[model samples]
Target chain A: MDIFNKMFGKNNVSSKTVAKERLRLVLVHDRANVSPQLLETLKEELIKVISKYTEIDNSALEVSINNSEHSVVLVANIPIRVRRSMNTVC
Target chain B: MGEVIVVTSGKGGVGKTTTTANLGTALATLGYKVVLVDTDIGLRNLDVVMGLENRIVYDIVDVVEGVCKIKQALIKDKRYGSLYLLPAAQTKDKTAINSEQMKQLCGELKKDFDYVLIDCPAGIEQGFKNAIAGADKAIIVATPEVSSVRDADRIIGLLEAAEMDSPKLVINRLRPDMVKRGDMMDIDDMIEILAIDLLGVVPEDETIVISTNRGEPAVTDKNSKAGEAYRNIARRITGENVPLMNLTIENGFFQKLKKLIGLRDS
Candidate 1:
């Protein structure tokens, strides 16, 4: 009885979860009208632009899109590595 | 004259018709002359929900097409003498009535009635445009679920884009037990996500289904909690200071203790 109860308890699908997923996807598309391909292109361009300023770890850098009902947010994370000399050049 | 208000939900089966029927009845009970217009066109149900489907001899199309006058098309509610219904055309599609025609009809109705409540069709389509054309305010009805709330948010945005002022919200069919268990989105969470003024919250009551089946409004039964909530919404619309119904809090030990100690305050 306990096993049956545990197996069936609170595992039902909810409308709220479905709605949240739908809204998330729709908002992502609705904000900038940017397709996934375009996002990839944007990420590549962002990496190229940031490389001119500093040595950015290309593999570690990330760029993506975040959206809400009213606005689209472009998020980018760049990791910069600097090498320090232990002694002055002789 | 009082303003025209449209009760709309972008998602179907979220109780837009039910809310419109109950609110119209409640408003009329308060001595306000209210006219509930069904703008669903071919898929009309507001008339049936209000139990006036059998009486719809001349519908909105007849009035729009000049076959019958608006006065002839309007059906007075059998229960509430002050309430009226302008039903949709069952045979015709939504394309038959344009936004301008709806605006004109509502304008004419405004001369006679204090409140003109339009029951908008689901989706952001021609029917929706026609429904909200002449409304001064909007009331978005949504269930506690995310899909309903998301649709409502979209509808609210559409209303804003149309230059309509702050649309109030009605979160319907909220199951408080699920909310307490952290299974469902609480009222506060919904309000936070939607960012709108809350008109009222209606609990999921089986009495609503029974009453709808009987072709009677749930509000007519005073003993029903959902009925009381609808009445309170009516009172609020009339500029009364009716306290919001707290669905999350049951009227049991905690409530009684708070009241007994005079700690209960809005």
Candidate 2:
């Protein structure tokens, strides 16, 4: 099945789907007026900053900019996995 | 005297020209003399959109340059006798006409027509500045997408900075199904973000494309949903109270059956 069928069943691609995809990319670009390369650089810099504080599951963490109506937000989602030996050391 | 209103959007391809053409036609059909001005110089499309490109002998540049009188450039619409068009000069750049010239032209147009609708170009540059000058009101057109909404917000700020009165908002190409599915921003969310008076909401209808291609505005078609929305907007412009169109999708049979069994009303 195609991506549309897999996600929204057999119905035709609705305006909602189009709007969602368009808004996601548009908001990303509008937030900082930055290209995807710049976003990647920012993400890498963010990972470095967080790593200095604590051990994080960097592979699963998401760091990005969100464009809200009133302002732009830097959203960072970090996951913490506690090893038993590491907890004992703490 | 006629009220001059400029239809503007900061982003391109958001249907600013379409809204200007349709609203002008709608107002003319309502017995008001209306003139639609194409202000997108060098990339003029309103003349073609309004089906008056071939009929233009002189344009706004000719009027501003004193090559021809304003009366010579105004092309009357055959369908609506009171409706006319002041076509833009495709050969000249936007700098050919400054904000002062535009204000003077609109001041002259106000003496003859009941409504002068200026179709502004995209972007926040000299062209946009020229379009909004000497306008008593403004209509900001925006699609439901984030980019269009963001551009519209920027345009609203510029209008405020120009000391223009509160402009009405027209949310175009909205899909009811998307709002219901939580996939798109609803009308309330858009209003909350923009903080402008809601003028009208137009659904995404394929008939708009067809009518536009045929050089006929969808507003004249009684069967078109978008047309009805435009007509309602024109009515509202004339200080009439018209209820908003019902663009919600009908509930499916299975959903209705589930609701009945659950004794829920939605």
Candidate 3:
């Protein structure tokens, strides 16, 4: 997505999209009443715990709050490279 | 009991006072008794906008301080007999009154008025707290700009934390031309960002400026599109299902015909 954004960044980037992207980031942090530093702390803790079992994509990890029309959702997307070893799975 | 609605925006100059004045006037014109409370202490403007500024002998501070009765502090509107103004004190700070006093005052007023519209001061501060203390619901006002919408989002969070239910949003000063060109934020974009039910949208109309300067709400000015939007909102508050007005440039009848016949691209 970053590569895609950079490829046609000039003509394709509308002010509305910029506004949406910015708002999305801000509202997510705000909705949870969780500071960015706190989110970082949460992310690190989760990574340490998960990486103990399997190879996790730290670069691809995304943790944020999502606000729908009626509720606030805490969303976490952590990509796993493979299944855990038998020791952890068992 | 009357519903107490607080009109607030965390950012200033986004038209909270104006919406309060116009909505109050519209509800009053519909034959319901309405009272406008200027809760922006020390910098009150709702009375001035309602054209009842000069009639103020007592204010919200006075009523809370026991200097005057609430009825005495309530000033009758120059135009609508059923409408009234509870002006905020010009010399007092936000500390002069608290939320408990506001809740009591609103409780007293609820018995007599059909709608109590509170004009909240900008920011998530003491004034904002006092204004929303008694409110059963909230109406957040914001513009299309990033900063304004950001502040509005913050305020909405506060409103919910204060236990106010499902605060509606009103997007003010929307420019259709800019929206059509994809330059400015559209109403749908704002609703998506804010994640709130849109109460209404008021297009940027000069009549609101002219009318506010004259200390009269624009809703009485039939020709103003902004005024029409506000009246519709007032009706919606009273449980009427009014459609959102299309502020886009009108297509001529022939243009519509051509589009219908697939002769022109939409």
Clashes of each: 0, 0, 0
- The alpha-carbon deviation from the true structure for residue A40 of candidate 3, after best TM-score superposition, in angstroms, is 4.2
Model 2 chain B is weakest, by summed lDDT over 10 consecutive residues, at: B257-266
Give the per-residue lDDT digits (tens) of candidate 1, residues B9-79.
89999999999999999999889999999999999999888888788889999999999999899999969
Runs with alpha carbons beyond 4 Å of true place in candidate 1:
A1-41, A44-61, A65-72, A78-90, B249-266
Worst 10 residues of 1 chain B by lDDT: B257-266
**Per-residue lDDT tens digits of candidate 3, residues B138-225?**
9999999989998999998888777789999999999886676466899889998888999999999999989989988899999999
Candidate 1 accuracy as TM-score: 0.81
Give the residue spans of candidate 3 off by over 4 A. Answer: A1-10, A40-90, B251-266
Question: How would you order the candidates by TM-score, starting with the best?
Answer: 3, 1, 2
- Report residue B119 deviation for candidate 3 (angstroms): 0.5
TM-score of 2: 0.75
Can you rank all candidates by DockQ, best first?
3, 1, 2
Task: For each candidate in the order shown, give its overall lDDT on alpha carbons.
Answer: 0.85, 0.87, 0.88
Pairs that collide in candidate 2 are none
- Model 2, C-alpha of B114: deviation from truth (Å): 0.9
